[model samples]
Every structure is written in structure tokens, then in C-alpha cells.
Target: MEFIILVASSFTKLLDPVVLAYVIAGFIIGTIFSAIPGLTATLALALLLPLTYSLDVTIALMACASIYMAGMCGGSITATTINIPGAPSSMMTALDGYPLQKQGKGALALGHAAIGSMAGGAIGAMLLIGLAPFIAEASLLVQTTGKFSLLAFAMVVIVIAQRGKVIKAAMAACIGLMLATIGLDAMEPVTRFTFGFSSLTAGIDLMPVIIGTFAISEILMQAGAAKEDRKMTEAMSAVKIRRRDFIPPLSSIREIGLACYIKSSLIGYSVGTLPGAGGSMGSFLAYVETVRTSPNPESYGKGNPKGIAASESANNAVCGGALVPMLTFGIPGDPITAIMLGVLVINGIQPGPQLMAGQADLIAPVLASLLFSAVVLIPLTLFLLGPYFIKIVSIRKDILYGSIALLAVVGSYVATYSTFQMMMALVLGVLAYYMRKNDFPVVTMLLGFILGPNLEEFLRRSLALSNGNPMTFFTSLDSLFFVILTLVFVYFLAIKKPLQKPTGAAQSA
Candidate 1:
């Protein structure tokens, strides 16, 4: 009862004018960032990370939560309006949404997307609140060998989950793991890989990497894509949408059915709990399941509201599920959560099994922000801004990306007041841009960097205890479970995935 009261009171704290203002502002910023192609919630968070240095930790967390939820749902705006998905997860949404736009039902499709986001987001947040403590407790039971196997599992899953690009992903992960070794040794006082620079003593700051990978690289990518988006900007000038039409009708809701929403949310949450799955996978799986089970499966890519519902719901719910590993085990489930972990770390919070028990007050408001943003903000933003979607899409690329680049460079400097780190950000950005051009998954690299320390630490400890015995992993039950689990994931996510027939959206795409 006390815990419940604490959470409820923590939620009520969002009603404070200052906190509420930050949440609303963050949501709007995140929505705009994600609504524009190539810009993402991750980018928004990366750019704003320096600001978190001055803000209260709870406020920063709440804002991040709102931003994440908004990013997931806001992509539907462009997907429904322009046939171009603003986010990768919204690719499935565009298949049906663009058709609906042609039929003059685009606003309604966006409405359906909003409703689905609300349902999935709310349910996912509630599930996180209910299940995190138990998971955290369970996490504590895992010994060192189990921890190593789990990190190994996460790394392998992330690499293989790249679908057909396993080799490239592995290469990126290896690079990330290598980069992680540049700092002081985790155990001893000596630094092995510093390459003889005084600046190497402290290692690379996370801010530089994040700003470079998502923010600076995005700017570099968008600088070249401006011409491609020009036609879409001109297209937006000819299109107009009515705000009132953004509200779904009772008949449409009845058609989509509550069961579909519930199932999709559950699927999203389940997928979110898996390392490397992220929102796109959650949306794809939910949408595929919905199509498989629907009575009129053929209607999905033909402007079906159910398709919008499945995609938006699953993607938005990913925010809640993705946070589990970040909060409990200090392992990021996705890139955004990896950045979010950076935020928590900047605020002096070290996430572990004990974090929940120790800092429920700070955590509750963050979860509440996730719930509130989905339940209230998604629809509110739609109803208020739906009619002006064209205006947003029509913003000049030069001004938008120019501002982002400035912020990225400045934020990199702000991290430690070092020009070297800012230069590092630019260098990393160039690296990320080229990697992305070649279809390398930068996310796996980021995950590998984030998880590398613990992975190495756990492995060395386990090996040291076992007198360098390689079979110790197999001898330990917990370690064996994950070893088998990794094989299971390899078979399914890697081997079995390629043989399956493409879904309705995948086929159409």
C-alpha cells in the first residue's frame, strides 16, 4: 500500500507547473524531431543531454520519457500525410496510411494511430511498473558467470538481429568493443590502450559518442538528402488536413477491436524485453500478427485503420519495455535507452538491481510521464496540431539541420569543456555516416560499447575463478541456460527469419 501511494504521489508531482511544462516542451520537440525523416527521438535526446546537466534528475527523466513516447507516435504524422515514414518503425504504418491519404482518410488514419499509441503506451508503462521490481529481484539472483553469458547473449542477439547483415553488425560491434578499451583498465590503475595521450587517461566521454553517432551523423546524412526531401516539401504545400477529422469515430474503433490493441501491446512489450529487438521489430511483429489473425487480411495495406493501430501501438509501447534492461541491469535494450542510460549516469545514478528499491521516488515519475504522455498527449497533440501537419513537413531543411549541427557540436563541448572531445564527436560522426551508408547497424555498435565493460569484467572474473577453465560456462546452470538461450535466439532471429515469407507491408515495400 505504501509503495502504491508513493507511486501515485510521484505521478501527482507531474501536475506541478514546472515539471509539466518541461514534459510538454520535450514532447513537442521530440515529436517534431521524429516527424522529420532522418531525425529521431534518439537525436533529440542526444542534443538535449547537455541541458540535463543543469536540470533536476527527476525532471530530466520525466522529459525523456515524454520525448520517447512522442517520438514513437509522432512518426505516424508523416507516414499518413506524405507516404514517407518519419521513423523506421512507421514503415508498416505508411503502407496503409498513404493509401488512406489517397482516399481522403489520412486524418482518420492518424487518429487511429494516436488511439493505438495511447492504448499500447499506457499498458506498457503499467506493465513496467508492475513487473520491474520482480525482474530486478530476479536479476540479482544471476551470478557472475550468468551475467557474462547474459551480456554475451545480448551482444550476439544484437549482432544477429540485423537480419541479413550479420557480418557488418559483428564488425561494428567489434569496433565498439575495441573503442571501449581505450580508457583506464577497469581493474588496475594502468591504462593499456591510451596510445600515449594525456587526454586518453579519462577515456572517451559518452556525450561525444552519442552526439556524434545520432546527432552529428544525422546532420551529415540529411545535408545530402535535402534534395530528395524537396519534392516532398513541395507536395506538402498542396496538401491540407482538418484537425477535427483527427478524432476516430466509434465505428472505426469498433472495427479495430480492443483485443487487437491488447495483443499488439503485449507483443510489443514482449519484444521490447528482448535486447536489440527495439521498436521497429515490435511494430513489425505486432503488425504481422494482426494481419495473420484478421478476418480481412487483404484490407491491411489498403487503408485499414487496424494496420495503423497495430503499428503505432506496438512501437510506442516499446519505450516502456526497452527501459527494463537499462534500469535493472545497466544494459540498454535499444539505442534511445542507451542514451537514456547516459542521462541517468550523468545524474550520478548507477543502475543495477538495487536501483528500483533505492530510487523508486525518482523512477515513478518517469514511468508516470510515459503513461501520461501516451494517454493524454498523443491525442491532444493530434487534435491540436493535425490540421497543421503540412506546416511542420514544410520546414526548411537548411535551418532545421543547421540548428541540430550547432547543438551537437556545442553539446559535445559542454560535456567536459574540451575541444578535443568536440573534435572526437565530429570524427565519430564521420565514421557513423560512412558506416550507415554501407548499411552497418550503428545501434549494435553503441550497444556493444555500452555493454562491453560489464561483459569484459564478468568474463574475466568468471575465468579467473575457474582457473581459466573454458568449460566452467557449461558447468554452471545459469550460464548454460543463456548459452542455450543464445543458440535458440541464433536459430530463430538469424536462421529461421530469412526463410519466412515477407509480410503484407514487407512485400509491398
Candidate 2:
């Protein structure tokens, strides 16, 4: 009954004209940003973070949540209309979506994508609401050792998931940890990496790193590619799309079946709860599993609507799922949520078990905004602006890249009002460009940077409490469980899976 009243009150607060306008505007902006290749939702949020300083906390959070939801769905627009995926999470969608477009069934592909996104977003939101409180309660049992172990597990999982590039991923992650150490030492008050500058003592800000890594580096890469690439107009001509083409037939939805949507959403949500496992992994895993289990597996890569449905649903579902750890445990599952954590902190709200127990007013409204965004996505994408979205891909590359570069520069400076931050952004951008070109998994580096301080702090605190005993981690059952869990994950992701290929080859020979 209390939960019901809280939700009702949140809806009432969100219905204000100003708040609704922000949400709508955010959704539109996010759609445009994510529909363009090289512009991701993370970049959108990072750019918008400075603007939130002047707005009310509730209003700012509402806009962020709405944008997050819209961005996750907008990638499918380009993936289906063109061969390019707007976001990494939509790579799976491109495999089947482009084929459908070639077959002149682009509208059918889009319809399935939109429906799957809506269902997944809604289900993921429900799971977050149901699971957050319980998870918070359970988190109280974990001591410092267990928390340290959990973070170690998350880092190892992230690196191992890099597939054949675990070594490169580890190297990149180590670089991030090194960068994170530039600030004050987590345990002692003494500065370690100041390098004689007073400003360095304050440490590197996350805003500069995030902006530089994602936005500025992307601009550099695009600029380099533009030299050899043909004009957008010459490469691909735009197709004429009508309103009637946006609707999916009833028969098509029935063929996809309710079970697939539910299962995919569940997988997305579960993966989202794991730190560092983002929407890209969720969509990829869900799409692969759906293909493996489908009776018509042969049709998966050749314009199958089920492939589009599975990919879209899982990626969109990740939005709500990623929030669970961020809100309840103060651990961000991915880069976007890491930015959202900054939003909450800037507004004077600290995340943790205490947050869930005491800040229902703030948290409830954000949850309401998520559900409202999913409901609004259907009309906004399908009925109101379906045809116009197809034309988004026709935008000029030079103009887009130029505008983003300008935004990245101004946004980074505005975040700190310091020339040093702008320089930091440029340096990181160059480094990130090289890292990306080398396929070193920059996201893993980011994950390491974000979690490094926390891991170090927890480890130090645990050791201090145990009088420097090395076996202290095994003394507690919670810590022991996490330690074992980390080993198991490492074995499967790093060792057992890699060895399987050789064994199979030997048997075949």
C-alpha cells in the first residue's frame, strides 16, 4: 500500500508541464544522438551532465532516465535502415535488420524491434522495482572483504569477456587503474602522483576522462576515416518510407512468441545486474541464444524477425537492469550508470542501502520516469515520427563530426571551468583513439578506473580490521563465497572456454 501511494505521488509530481517537457525533449534529443553512428547514449548523458547543475534534482533525473531509455531503442532505427549500427549494442540487430531492409521488409523489422523494446523495457522496470529492496537487504551481510572480493570478481569477468583479447584487455585495465591512482591515495592522506602541480593533487576528474575517451576519440577516428570514405549521398541512397510500412502484422508478432521476449528480457536484466556487463553483451548473448534455440535457425542471419526482436528487447531491457546496482549498491554496471551516479552525488544524494530505505521520494520518481518513458516510446517512434527517422542516416558526416567535436570541447571545460580539464580531455582522447584502434577494449579500462578506488579502499579496510592477516578473507562465509565465485568465473571465462577449441580440434582429427 505504501509503495502504491509513493508511485502515485511520483506520477503526480512528474505530470507538471515543465517536467513533462524536459522528458519529451530529452527523449527526442537522445533519439537523434543514438540514431547517428559514432554518437552513443553515454556521450549524450556526459554532455548533458553539466546542464543538470541548474535544474531541480527530480527534473534532471527524469530527463536522464527518459533519455537513457530512448537512446537504447534509437540504435535500431539506423541498424535496420542502413548497414551501420548506431550503438555497439545494436550490432546483433544489424545482422538481421539490414537483410530485412534488402528484402523490402524494413517496416516489419522496425515493428518487431519497437515491440520487443517496449516489452523488454517494461519487464525490466518491474524486475528492478521488485528486486532492489531485497538486494539491498542482502547487501547488509557483506563485509569489507566480501565487497573487495566482489569487485575483483567483476574486474576479472570484464577482462575475460574480451574473448581472444584478454591480454590486451588486462593491459588496458591496468592503465585505467594507473590513471585512477593519480588522485590522493585511498588509504593515506598523502598524495602519490601529483607530479609537483597543485591541481594534480585533486586528482583526475571522471568527466574529462569519459568525454575524452568516448566523444573526442570518436571524432578523431571519424576524421581519419573521412579522408578515404565516399560521401554519404554516394554510398547509399535514401528509401521512401510510408506510414503504412511502420506497422507489423499480427501474424508476425505471434510467430515470435511470448516466451522469447520474456526470456530475452530476463537475460538482459540479469546481465545488467553484473558490474561491467553492459547492453552490448546482453543483446549479443540473447541474440545468440535465441538463434541456437530457434527451430528455423537457418533463417537467423537471413532476414529473420526473431533475431531483431531478441536483440532489441535485450538491449533496451538493460537500461532498467543497469540501475539496480547503481541505486542500491553504489556500484554502476556500465558507463552510463556511472554518469548517473555522478548526477545523484551532485544532487547530494548518496547511494547505498541507506538510499533505498530513506530516499523513496527521489528514487520513486526516477522509477516512474523509466516506466513512463517505455510507454511513451511506442507512439513517439512508430506513429508520430517513424518516416522521419529513416532520413536521419542521410546527415553529412563532416557536419556531424564537427558539431560533436565542438560539444566535447565545451562540455569538458564546462564540467570543471578549468583549462586543465580541457587539456586532460584532449590527452585522454588521443590515448583512447590509439587504444580503440588497437582493439584494447577501452570500456574495460573505464570499468577499472571507476571501480579501482573502491576495490583498494575495501581491501585496505578489511586488512586493517583483521590485523593484516592474509587469511581474513576466508574467515567470513560471505567473503569465502565471493572468492570461490571469482575463481569459478575466471576458470570458465579465461581457461576452460579457451581450451575447448583445441580439444574439439583434436577429436575431429
Candidate 3:
């Protein structure tokens, strides 16, 4: 009874007209960013950070949070309309989404992605309401030892969770980690890999690196091929969502929905909370986990709605999940969060333990923004934006790819107007292309780059706290459990699984 009242009261606060308008504006901006290739949520937020400096924290957080949430969903527009994925996290969506679009089910695919995102966002917000206090309480107890162990566990899982050649994944991860080491040492002012280039002192901005690696590289690889028309041939029946198709059967929804929601939410939250692991990791990990556990795992690469649900929902959930740590600890979970950090600091709201305690009103509006933004996005995406999505497919592939390539270079240079940034983009693009040819998962490499700094920082901090004693890394119960879990995961992924590889039909059976 008390919980219900509290929730109802919170709901009432979100109904403010001014708050609702800002939330809607944020969604529109975010969706626009998602529609453009190479324009990521992180970059979008960073660009807006300075503008938010004079605004109140509530408005600032709302603007940033809304963009982060909608950006994850907006990627599906390009993923479905064209073969290109607007976000790396939407790559799997491209596999089936584009195929469905080619079959003239573009509206259906868009509908599914949008609806799945809404469901995921709603559930994630619910979880936030229920679990924030609990998670925050637990996070407060995480000392340096526990933080390092948890980070280590995340790295181990990232490598082991990758499908295909584990060695290649490990190699990619190492490369990313090395790239992360290019910046100055966290504890010391000494540079590690800058090579005396003044521009390299801050290391490479993660936004440009990722944009170049994924978006630019993708375009360059495909630019040689002539554009083929992928426009939908059959006319969409109607904009209506059929009652039968509106929701899965109760039993099916109960079974698959629970699996999708829980797995996606947990994976989404875990990855989102981790310093470097972002929406891409969250969605990819959820999709992978879904495949690993599904009875019809073979259906994943196809247009399986379950796979779409898992990926879409997980990525969307990451929006709110990411905010928990950022708001509470002042530590950005991923690239977008780092940008959000900039926004918060610009707004004169220093995020940390005192944020929630001292500024509950500001926090409430941000939370309100998450719930309301989705509500606004759904109608806008379904009705006003539906035709625009279809229109994107009409653009020639040559033009699309060319523009993306140019943007990748421009965005890279804008991050730091240095020739080295462009060179790094080209080099990484070539490496990524070769790596892709060999079936090495580039996403894992991205993850390693993202997590590398945090892992190093945490490890060093843990060691320093214990006077250089390695045992300090496992002083807490959470740290101990994660260490054991890491070892067990490694054994299965690296060793035991290889021993079970199929020699013939015998293994298949």
C-alpha cells in the first residue's frame, strides 16, 4: 500500500507540462542523431553539454537522458530502412531487420523495434524504481578491491562472451586495451604512448575513435560495390497494428517475455553500469546470451522476433541503467555517460554521493524524463516519423556511404584537428576490415577499448589502497565471488568448450 502511494506520487510529478515538453524535444533530437550515420548519442550529448551550462540540473539531465534513451531506438530506423546500422549496437538488428524491409515488411519491423524498445524501457524504469536504492546501497560498499575485481570480471566476461574464434577476440580486446593506454597515466602526469604529439596528450577521444572504427570503416569497405535498390516493393497494408499481432500469446510472452526482459535487463544494467561497456555491449551481450540459452538458437540470425526483442530491449534498458552510476558516483559508465558528466558539470551540478540526497527534485525530473520521453517517442515514431523512415531507403547507397565516410573523417578531425586522428581512423579501419574478414568480432575490441581505462584505474587504485598487496583486490565478498566466477567462465569458454568441438555428425547429435 505504501509502495503504491509512493509510485503514484512520483507519477504525478512527471505530469508537469514543461517537463513533458523538454522530454519530447530531447527524444526528437536523439532520434535525429540516431538516423544519421556516424552521429552517435555520445557526440550529440557532448555537443549539447555547453548549451546546458546555464540551465537547471533537472533540465540538463532530462535533455541528456532523453537523448541517450531515444538514440538507442533511433538506430533501428536505418537498420531497418537501409542495410546500414546507425549504431553498432543495432548491427544484429540489421541482419533480420533489413531482410524484412527488403521483403516489404519495413513498417512491421519498425513497429516491432519501437514497441520492443518501449516495453524494454518501461521495464527498465520499473526496475530502476525498485532496485536503485538497493543497488546504490550496495555500490556504496564497493571498496577499491571490489571495484577492481568487478572490472576484471567484466573484462573476462567480455572476451569469453564473444562468439567464434576466442583467440581473435582476445587479440582484439588486447588491441583496444592498448589503444586506451595511449593517454597519460591516470595516477601520474607522465604520458604513456603519446609519442610527444601535443594533440595526443589527452589520448584519443573515444567518440571519434569508435565513429571512425565502426562507421567510417564500414562505409569504406562497402563503397566499392555499386548501390542496389533495396526499397520496399510491396505497399504496407496499413499503419494499424493487428490485435492478434499486438502482443505475443500469454504463455509465449510469459516464457519468452520473462526471458527477454530479465536477461536483457540484467545484461543491459550490468554493461551499462560498467565504466566502458556501453549500449553496444549491452544489446550484443543480451542477444548472445539469448542465443546461447534458446531452444531454437538457430533462429537468431534470421528474423526471429525474440532476438529482436532481446537486443532492442537490452539496449534501451541501458539508458536508465547507465544513469544510476553516473548520477550516484560521478563516474561515467560509457561514452554517452562521459558526455552526460560534461553536461552535469557544465550545469554546476557535481554528480556524486550527494546528488540524490541533496537534489531529489532535480533527480525526479530526470527520472520523469525517461518515462515520458518514450511515451512521446512512440506516437511520433509510429505516425509522424513512419513515412520518413521509409523515405531513407530511397537514398542511393553510394551517396549514403560516401556521406558517412566523410562524416567519420570530419567528426574525427573535429574531436581534435590533428592529422594523427585521421591516420588512426584509416589504420583502424583497415585493421577492422581485415579483422572482420577473419570473423573477429570488432564489438569485443570496442568493448576492450572502452573498459581498458576503467579496469586499469580500478586495479591501480585497489593496489594503492592495499600498499601494493595483490590480495587487496579480493578483500570484499563481491570481489571474491566475481574472481571465482571469472575463472569458471574462462575454463568453460577457453578450454572445455574447445574440447567439445564437432569432429563430425556425432558431435552435432
Tell me, by TM-score, which candidate is best. Answer: 1
State which candidate, 1 or 2, has the greater lDDT.
1
Best by lDDT: 1
TM-score of 3: 0.67
Candidate 1, residues 9-51: lDDT per residue as tens digits? 7878887999999999999988888888777888999999999
- Sort all candidates by TM-score, best to worst: 1, 2, 3
Each prediction's whole-model lDDT (CA)? 0.86, 0.80, 0.66
Q: Each prediction's TM-score against the native?
A: 0.97, 0.92, 0.67
Clashing pairs in 1: none
Q: Write one digit per residue (lDDT tens) for candidate 3, span 1-509.
A: 33323444655655777766666777776776676555566545644543464566667777777888888888877776665677776766666566666666666667667766777776666666566656555666766677677667766766665646767878988988898899788889899888878777888666555655566556655764445532332222222223233333456445456667667867876677654456777777777777778898766555666666787788888877877766665555665766666556545576655666566556666666676666556545556756655444345556755665666666556544666777777777777777776788676676677667878988887777778888864666767877987788678655674422112112211
Full-model lDDT, candidate 2: 0.80
Clashes of each: 0, 0, 0
The better-scoring model by TM-score among 2 and 3 is: 2
**What TM-score, to 2 decimals, does candidate 1 have?**
0.97
